[model samples]
Target: MKLFNRFPAIIHHDDSTTAPSLDASLPARKWETILFSTVLIWTFLGLCFPMYDTDFWWHLKTGQSILAGNGIPGLDLYTFTDADKPWIDLHWGFQVLVAILYAIGGVPLVTLVKAGVVTAAVAIGWRACGNELPAWKKSLVWIFPIICIAGRGNERPEMLSQLFLAMWLWIAWRSEKQPDWMWWLPVLQIIWVNCHALFVLGLIVGFSYAVDAVIRTRWGGRFGLEPRTDGPPLGAVFVVAVLVALACLINPYFEEGALFPLTLYRKFSVEKEFYRQNIGEFRPPIDFVMQFGLSNLFVISELIVWLVTAASFVWLLVKKGRWSPYRLILFAGYSHLAWQASRNTNIFALVSAVIACQNFAAAEVIRSVSVAGSTAGDRPHQTGKRVKLAQGMTGLFVILTGLVVSGVWNQIGEKNKPFGLGEAPNWFIHDAAKFAGRDGFPMRAFVAHIGQAEVYVYHNGPLRKVFMDARLEVCTQQTFELYNGILAAMAAGDPIWQNLFREGEPPVVILDSRSSRPAINGMLQNPTWRLVFADKTGAVFLHIDTATRLSLPPVDPSPLMYPDGEPKEKSRGK
Candidate 1:
């Protein structure tokens, strides 16, 4: 036993061994209590309020279809008009899981499920970092994920992608010291490729690992620091990359499913509306520079994550030797992503949090404190001042939690309305039964009566299938030009308005009042298209066709006008 203790350096223990006596290292019951408490607190604060623009309903619908034994559809199935259009089920696996959740419970259950998955992902990432982190620093990991959760709460295919990213990082870090562990890469890739289109990132990460391996091999021998390479390090990484690329072909659309994102990326470059439309994730942080109120808490949290990350990178270089080239490249990539949009800031925050914990845990300053018998540890520790500081901080957090529960946190409730127009208007259709009476209308419905209802020259919804939703980025350049042209023509009474809503146009057009003011105005200009029903939030436009002209009455223009003579202006000044 004395020899084992003295020769501890001979066998490399995992990083978690450093904190053998922390409360986090308690028995299984205590550990579970701590973990579950963290999960519950974060889930309530982060996942309970859904954000607008979360296409979760569509994902649920897709899952429902898959569960019904239809499997993954090769073409779009939700809309009647575009039912035959080619579509790829890129996120089939994730869809199936979400569908099962929806089927067993309802939408609320989805929140719980998402919360659990995200919490688990964060926990796994932290655990993978080992026990080198002190209790204070470890607690910060929970806060880090919370900062990201608000921006990342959307129910999209990317949720799975994010989880996969955490997993990949954990695995890659483990493989660094245990070369034999590289075999797990391919297995993870197989699952990732089937879950989300972001699996391409995994392939890129794998390729980087392989390149790093070759570099290490050539240089390590010269420096007397050779690592074991006989294991499947290079081979496993290569095989996984190839297999994951091929696994993308497992979807119903086969190769098209794999290539759809690339195609969309190319098409998105030329789209004007997509470029102008501010997705929560896409909006820049510059807008919040002047908002010094509590309303800016989310933005403030995001800025801290970015600033801390940048500082950590500098510290890593100055305190430790230069970081590995691969880590430097990954950090640079994250920095670029952070600048792209506010949403990308989550990625930066997560990466920064991990690096911060690792660096803080490994610092000589922290080690010296441990050796000096200060702070929380297994040894006889100092409790006169530092322990009191920790207890006071805990009390402050408890007060914050209490405030959050007593409706003070609900002040952010106004910001929590998920649907774009504050609430679903009376005209909104929550179920399919609402549309049964309007079967004669050739238009299709997508969640709450929002869908494409016309065919314009560049906007091909009335004739051809739409590339995606009514969002600007989903349409062709011509579609955006036509949309903008139509908007300009609305005030000028341009001839283009005549072509947009001719007599034989699509039977019905659903307009999202939150996003589509120009198209709605053009429809209102032409007398041939009438508003069947209008509400404060949204409206439905029906074509005055020969088949259903008598069933629909002339819409009262008075409802659409303000108390004054002017038309109710919907657009916020651009």
Candidate 2:
């Protein structure tokens, strides 16, 4: 009786485990469709961060000024501390471009341009993953790299560098076969100088190409490499190199812009420790791993990259392949960059994709050969399976192309929607103009204190240059420390807040009551400051030094208070 009972139980358990798995083999067409949908979905998802990068405000504002002023502002117009500090607007060209787009269709157009620019960069990077690979494998390989870098593709000047880097890689590869196009490399520096501060990266690419060509010619046998006879003759590269250096100086800043990268890097670095350590992006990789654990996506992605890089080295060794010195240099350089800062991971992805995809091609090529030359017994309908697989992949590429185009347009729509959830709302912005009148509030006289970027955009600014904005690097190095100290003192109920206002007094103050109760509490005791506006997003306090403060009636000291006696916005969320 016991044996019989056990036998039935065993039979049921076996059936339960095996039955579901028996249907594991998905059809090739369905699998391809699933993968295509998943990747496209993720690519679109990557485009969904809210515009919190304060740099956008200043950049857009600067662009607007350039348009109105009919030239780049030769001084910093948006800061009190650095006002008229002989500013070098290296991104003058990009600012004008933004001005033109914003003028054309407002935020929607600017959002679309950001998406389109990054998408085009992604396409260039996908192609630069190298030749001699199936389109399917190349696309699949590039997808993950895109996912890794998707976080950094916000509407900023860095996207331009991403595009330019891809362009340089494309030219570098083709220059092997058509070297005459290499002459145009210097011409790119002219545009790059006016675009972003990271234009030095472009010069690095050109030099790497020149060095690689010289090395292969001199060191063909040592690394099992043969001189690529298809490449440009090595002798002219020296003359072109000098021209590239000279070309970088053709900007309005002239030598200042050309040397911006060096000066900026020096400013950020102190001995061995970087001042960028204060920023999350520039922190050492170990800090992220320790803080977020091994499961952190950034750490996971970095490990996978290292694995892929190691695999490439192994593949090269096994195949006795000619590893292009330029590719190797790029991989090593960018890998170090990632190790140094979590933010630089995208650059690593850009360069390592090339190294990885090339190595991956050899393995994929082998699989391709195996599929075409399969043995008889294992697959009874080999020819049919091959045809189905081919049709599936071809269909997938077509659908992916359509999805990418459609997805970018969709992303633009997502970005254009008014501030919701993670974004800074325009409530304060709309009201500031009404309260302050046409002339606007005093510049840097009172702290905006909340949603720094949103204030600038909402006001249609040049109202008052703020003490803090997302344009951090452009601000003096000590500005953050100084601002934080002032904020801390106010929050601690110290009298230092009064002194700060006396010295740097902004006419109006925007307060986040929930997080800033201490500061707000201190202000409540001060008779001179009056609360003119209050909403769920923030509270604005006007300093009543004179009639010039504004024509609004005197505000009561007591605000709408919650149970804790601190003022709470009727509206919720920041």
Candidate 3:
């Protein structure tokens, strides 16, 4: 009888011992569930959208060129004026990948591939957040990726770098407990450094982790509550850092490619057009709320992060009595990045969500313990209610999923319609086909050939070099200036249209009958250029100086006499 009475107390102690182990397992399970959800959501969102950026044209053209035997062009080949200027393809690898996909599948397949990559990136970021945070806090990380996808809504290089950044952070965090894992850091850094210039961020994150390790060793280890270290041997971080830095030089242009971002930064700062114009990425974050017409969602999300951080700080003060230097550093870093640009809202959102989730998980564990103590008398009834509640929540989730799927299908259909997204004419495709075919055709033949050439190029022109294509960035400053100037002058009804007829113009200018009214009028009036071909789509102008002279009337020596001009009297008509 004495042993049986003592058995209850012994069993209770055993249960208490296993409770923490179970609690630890719950967080891991919760994190996995959240990460899976994030990937599915991001993939669905990406698949619902199409490539809508102006940069996509250049990406496609560059990819197409890479697919051909030309390899990466070291000189500007898009225009007659700057064909020999040295060219540096910063995005050559990305372009070549896209081109290979295009060759194998088509435009739609490329879109799907981009969407899939973005989905994977978001999944990686989501996993990092869950790994770093407590179970309840993981859900908070989901909101940021949601807002970021809605804001940017395109597959770009930054998306790829974001995944690498997340992976770096996760590895660095894990390295605190398993120093042997430090080797993977350099390898990841090497891949990231070559993939995008954003690889510089990996170095910064590594440095931060090293600083954190030093702080934790000096102060955190003394506190008794700090996590036990199984970190790598001495000088491991420095060696990895050096290796990662050197790994950046393995790109196509080597040092030039690695240092290209500095040049781009300088150009962006100095260029009036880029700085003065409203570029989507450069725009302030608050502006996105207005542009997208979101009702304080951005502000609310930001405040939620700040509020949770403040609460976490207070909780640390009351409970642990001191802040973890590493956490404080991360908080400050994210805060700075968030405030620097509106686009950085995503970064802030992810950081804040992770912190919030950690806090929530800690609070929930406390609540579960408190509830268990209070409800000890009614444990059996409480367990039954909890199981019913879980079932109800699952059913609710299923209903919501159905609604979201229906809405997404409708949205995808509306957004993917043909010509729903505007198509800019492929000037390079037209020009390349015209000049490469024959010596030179009449104006009409040139226009027909260029139009027909666009069709042929669309089908088979990958084998040939193009004069100009839709890849706007590959265009030299002179070519862009001339193209813009010609369009502007045409729009303003300027009389300087004869400049295009001067020696060495693009052999054939494809003039759409409806869109090229000004160019048509200019070609008709210019004495040195003649319209040798015309069709329903466009008219072609050829520089036939002799034929142009024969078509023009003789010049008169008399002053105040208009050449080929006959004065018409003003007439009054009813």
Identify the candidate with maximal TM-score: 2
Q: Of models 1 and 3, which has the larger TM-score?
A: 1
* Model 3 segments more than 4 A misplaced: 1-35, 38-46, 67-69, 77-85, 130-137, 221-234, 267-273, 276-278, 287-404, 408-487, 495-501, 506-574
- Candidate 1 residue-wise lDDT at 547: 29
Looking at model 3, residue 25 earns an lDDT score of 38
Error of 1 at 383 (Å): 7.3
Q: Could you tell me the TM-score of candidate 3? A: 0.64
TM-score per model over all chains: 0.74, 0.76, 0.64
For residue 492, give model 1's deviation from the true position in Å: 5.9
lDDT of candidate 1 at residue 38, scale 0 to 100? 50
**Worst lDDT window (10 residues) for model 1?**
1-10
User: Whole-model Cα lDDT per candidate?
Assistant: 0.52, 0.60, 0.50
lDDT measured at residue 196 in model 3 versus the true structure, 0 to 100: 60
Please give the distance, in angstroms, between residue 244's alpha carbon in candidate 3 and its true position after superposition.
Answer: 1.1
Question: Global lDDT for candidate 1?
Answer: 0.52
Between candidates 2 and 3, the one scoring higher on lDDT is 2
lDDT for 311 (candidate 2): 76
Task: Provide the global lDDT of candidate 3 against the true structure.
Answer: 0.50
- TM-score (C-alpha) between model 1 and the true structure: 0.74
